[model samples]
Target: MVRSDSAGNGGDAMKEHCGVLAIYSMENRPVAERIVKGLAALQHRGQESWGIAVPGEPILKGLGLIGQGADANAKKILSFTSNRGIGHVRYSTRGRTTLENAHPLDIRGEFAIAQNGTIANTEDLESVVEKEFPILGSTTDTKLAGYRLLQHYRAEHDWTRAFHKLSKELSGSYSFVMITHDGEVLAARDEAGYRPLCLGYDPDTDTHIVASESCALTALHADLVRDVQPGELVSLTKDGLKITKFAAASRHYHCPFEYTYFGHPSSKIDDHYVYNARRKLGRVLARKYPFKADVVIPVPDSARPAALGYSEESGIPMEEGLMKDRYRRKGSLRSFIEPTAKSREEIVREIITIKPVVDGKDVIVVDDSIVRGTSSRNIVQSLRDAGAKKVYMVVTFPPIRHPCYMGIDFPTREELLANKADGETLNVTDLNSKVAREIGVDGLGYNDINGLSEGIGLGKDEMCFACVTGEYLGLKKDPVLRTREEMKA
Candidate 1:
């Protein structure tokens, strides 16, 4: 569910690394402007920085929220014309946050690439790329992958073959969109479908669009086409959409967190509607956790659907006990992906606690997942200050014990709350008790992996539960299957 750069992963809260948007104007009309709209729709995936790459121009990139902040020229510069382009919104996991690392990473004039998901084994990839396609300034794995793409293309001459080679060379989750010097836009989903990437069409503009989520397509008034299949490479050009099954892992490992947390509620990932899946998660939580609370309060925005299902299933009235202070400067920020402790703190401050609803009541708070436990502690403290008689926590997803190496923000194993001081992951009951005590909650319940799979209508094997289960699937070319010791180290 997270979209953070596999490179800049350090913050406590889980982050969606990057959102990719690609638009190819069938009529060859200016699409640079539409790319901005699509990226804005996908901004939640990443907010630290954004950039767009189109042919015949240097990639336009900026640090911090797109078209805003100290980058005074962003708004105007993003308006530059191009009939087709690829755009990216980035949140780092393995690299520093700066314009130099902003994506749509490219080589001289051959191609540019923007991606969602982690290329966990970038160090090994360096031998294949670093010297020839050297990156400038601060580095992120994405910049390296960009050059690697070109390196493969150089040898293969055919992009489809190059992408297939890259698929074999790559060792983690990824969904990529790239633009060629000739304005060709191509999208490739990793072999396992580890991150979401889909296609859409806007009849009005006659544009072929690709984005991390279908929600971006909705923003462009585009019709949802099928998801770009796992191991599929789709090209959008004058010939329309050309799909090739460049590679396929033996099994698929779709990220479950998308349905639980990161994905836009209105979007569709594969065959499942994200909103419905979340509601099912809430219903499952209510059935299993069965809290006799006076009110069920959702951690704003992302958890709203799950909370609603919890309230409806439990017959406990759902109250808007907490709402984002939209008028506040940081109100729109998703706490988990804010990047900085200060920004994340501001997010906690932006929560408008409806004291009247929590006062003198036994309240059950529902949330997507607990990654670091910092936010949970602060949220519960706020409710206590609001006079909540008893506060219980119900989490939609299971406890996250291991760190995600696939484009998720929790790259360091020690940062996870479900682990011991020495970095040993805890069992469900022990983890629940420990997290509840640490967060000052009376009770806590986390969905187990099975419950989570059932709720999302997916079998355990169908999704990537590596962060929860410590079972990495489909990361190829000798995937770095870190042992507990190495993870802690």
Candidate 2:
């Protein structure tokens, strides 16, 4: 997610969003250790906290890396020996990063839920839930969802009916996985399809895996199945996979950012490969804004594919000019994790060490996106510090000029560099010039929105370009749907 306030090791340039995973095996085998491994693979989604919930065992959750906490306590989780479970890694787009805000949140110990995306009407819903239920343990939207589901189940002892009622009352992006006391795993995505969830099968163990990314299924050696259709629910039972549509929409607005930066490159969402899309984005950007540079260097891991595509298309030599330090504490581990304009500048100063590869050369620095401009600015400054003659910036995605209300953490327009002109989205060239001046770069170019959509091989109607275009699909026009400013008010 595009969190500007959170900081991390090299203060993370942006939030990693959240990851959700679940498994239901016909063999009735213990899945705690496997779930731990899957969570470790998905650590990039969110590092603030990790958690899991099985039918019979106590919920395992805590702050920090998943391997350190959940994996160490795998034995305790295995005592339940249930065949079905669900897990989540969170970065807190809605609530504070605390143990209470962790996912797989229990509902009176009857049902547990892990979800990605925000409920736009959280304040109103929270108020309603407070009157019917006990005071909530935490203020997270996901916890609220669990309680709301509880209210529905008690009124009508049917899970599907409860979910249908819940869907009607909530508005916004969500991909949810819920596990009941009966060992059934039910996964659903919101009508808009803003976040991702997919269903995969493991024939070897006769298991069905429902997760936020196909990469999680791949990590567990499961074959790729189609994505969980938007507004549809999939139930994994001993009787097999049951699919139903709880809500209906004429279109699906998949988050384009998923293909650009949010997803693991190995995962396929909606049949589009993320790595290929990024590489194609670079190719498109190079064609649109060709630069005369001696070499191209990536910002590191996430930008590597785009950098390679740029080098391939532009015929510039690609070099690894900066090194990423892998052993850094991420998420809400320290105060630095709460980023400010100053902290973002300091993070790039420490996290990436510059090599002499670009010395005496006009270098092109390729990054996936420029959220707040502080990290990009620091990167350009670092290159200058390393004796680079000139630095040009090539950003793959268009400028994020609007705060994402769906799920990404850039909740305020002021936090976005491109949205700084009294809430105006600047022209592409104007935005680039402004960012270039701030980052100390000789020149800057960004992929146009059309170019980005084309590179991802999807039409504008299929993806959520809300961050770039200042338009929110599937959102109701209401006062309760908040940006950071509204929330403060």
Candidate 3:
């Protein structure tokens, strides 16, 4: 368990939810090693803690990166031969980052479950479960949900029926994978589809694979079947694959942030490849905000494709103005995990080295989005110090004003840049000016909500922009921004 008494800085950007993977092998073989490889590909989604659960074997889990987290106990589960298994890589959003809160949480040693997304009514559901099962250990929603499922299974005696009943009582975002005591693998997504989940098939061994992103399937050489539809339940056994509609998709709010930042560039979500979607966002930004600059530079990894699209559309030459120290990538995680302010700034400075290409040249910087404006501010200051004549900031997503309630980490308005703007009414130009002034940039431009829809090739109704427009789809009440103190209470 990695315990920290320090509270985090306000400017830290949104964090991703957990990544889930489950495999059902037709041949009688252990799948824990393959699960590790697939999880390695999805490691970007989480870094705090990870776990793998094989039925009839002691779970393997620990804190920190996957390789560093697992110890000798890992081999006990890895060597155990099981036809079915489930794995999870987690970055805590709802609970403390500790071994006790890690995934593959078992429900009375009957079912093992791993989940991505926050359960909005976690406490209420826990209260409901305590009426029957009095003993509970962890504070994570995965544990609460698992106990609820166990309660349903005991009464209904059917997995599908139990899942259907569980679906009606739950709210908020979730994409879950589970392994039963008898070697059955099950998966499902919430009604609104605020998170991503998909199914795939392996041809070599005729195994079935399910994961949070399509990239995980690609990592294992599996062919993607389709995205598990919102409110759908999927089960895999030695017999075959069975999918059932547990609940109708009331309002589909596939997270737009997945394309903007969270998801891998190569992964496809809801029929759109994230890399192409980001490139389209850049093209739209260039057309909307035409800036005169000698060169364009991306903020690195996530913003690279968008910068390429901006350069192509604006006819401005794109250059690598900053060389990211590949070895320093691990240090970047400290910016998000460390609770102190000074450590965050120091990590940002160590990650990217300024190149002389932008010296005496007007530079245009393309970034995915600005959450707290910390990274963008640091990048802008670095550019100015490197002799860049002027710096202009172009963002792919619209200004985020409200906090996200689904599964994103920035759940409070105090951590948002657009919250600094003057009125409740959303004013793009006003918000842009305020953000530019705060980040110490000469000018700033953001994609409009409509433009984001057009670029991503989805209608405004098909995707969730609640963080930017404050139009929630499935939530009951307006999301309140709670401080860390309030969260502790």
Candidate 4:
């Protein structure tokens, strides 16, 4: 287990939840190898710790990148002869970044559990257990939820019934996968579907896989069967998959941020291709906030597709005006998830401004979204230093005016630029101008809520715009941001 005494702030922008994967092999073959691959593919969702659990063996877990973390137990984990097991890679939205808070947590030696998304009512979930069970102290929210389910399983002696009980009582978002001591795999998505979970199959190995994204499934060469429906539970055995709906999805509240920035462009979520959605987002921005520029540029990496769409729609040639310092070991790391302002700045500074492309040109820089204006400020200043005549910003997602509790980190309103405006009542135009000034850009235009929905090609009501609209669909009650000291008490 990896231990850290303290962790930095979760960057200056939006950080996401963990990634989860479960695999079952009919032939009882070594599944860890494939699970590792799938988890590696999903590593962008998390970088703190990686864990895997199989029946009749002690679960293996490590900290940092999966490849380096798994070095010591590589052979042992790789040789595990198990037919079914669950794996997780974590980027904590709850608790501290410590081994004790890692996922695939063992539950009373009878089961192991891991999940994606926050349990807004995690404190309340603990009430069902007997006092003798001890308070779920010094553990993450995942453990709180798992223990809650354990109480039900102990009474009913059935995973299905336990899940039914959990789904009914639990609040907030999750896509849970658990490994039973009996070597069966169970997967579920919360009713609101604030997170993505998909079912995939590997025909050659006769394996059933459940993962957080289609990219991970594609990495394993597994065919994506479909996304697990909201409020649905799937039980996987050698026989096949058994699906049960524990609740009704009267209205689905999928996260729009997934398509805009959090999701891998190659992945598909909720029946929409992420890459296509991103292109549409750029086109929408071009149409809504048409600006004449000598050339178009993207903020590297995630914004590349959006930049392409902007160029196509505006008839302006797109150029790689910014390039990541790929040669450096830390250069390729994502700045948005760096966990500290200093660290995020270090990574963002590594993004070199391609002077030849933007020098003396009126540049339109396309980005996925602006969280607190930290990285955007850095990028815009770099363009000025590189002799760019003008820099205009186009963001795919709307201004994140409200903190997100369902998932997609940045839990406090104070850290949000839109929310931090002089007053809370400024409209989009004034808010954009204020933010543009803060970020040192000539001008800025943000995709509105309606534009965001249209870009993703999903109905506004069917998506969670809570981060922008402040209307939560999955929260049972208004969430309170608890202090760590208070939580420890």
Better of 1 and 4 by TM-score: 4
Q: lDDT tens string, model 4, 114-170?
A: 889887775575555535366444345666777788888888887767777887777
Q: Write the per-residue lDDT of candidate 3 for residues 26-132, one digit (tens) a residue.
A: 87667877788788778878888888887767667777777665544465655767777888998865345666667777666677788888776665676888787
**Which sections of candidate 4 miss by over 4 Å?**
1-16, 130-132, 481-489
Q: Which residue pairs clash in candidate 4? A: none
* Candidate 3 local lDDT, residue 185: 86
Q: Point out the higher-scoring one by TM-score: 1 or 2.
A: 1
Each model's lDDT comes to: 0.81, 0.76, 0.78, 0.81
Q: Candidate 4, which ten residues in sequence have the lowest lDDT sum?
A: 6-15
Ranking by lDDT: 4, 1, 3, 2
C-alpha RMSD between model 3 and the true structure? 4.5
Q: Could you tell me how far off, in angstroms, the CA of residue 264 lies in candidate 4 after the best superposition?
A: 1.0
107-209: candidate 2 lDDT, tens digit per residue: 6667778888877666666777888874553256776776787888899887778778988888778888888877788899887888999989999999889
TM-score of each: 0.92, 0.91, 0.92, 0.94
Predicted model with the maximum TM-score:
4
In candidate 1, which residue ranges exceed 4 Å CA deviation? 1-16, 67-79, 131-138, 421-426, 477-489
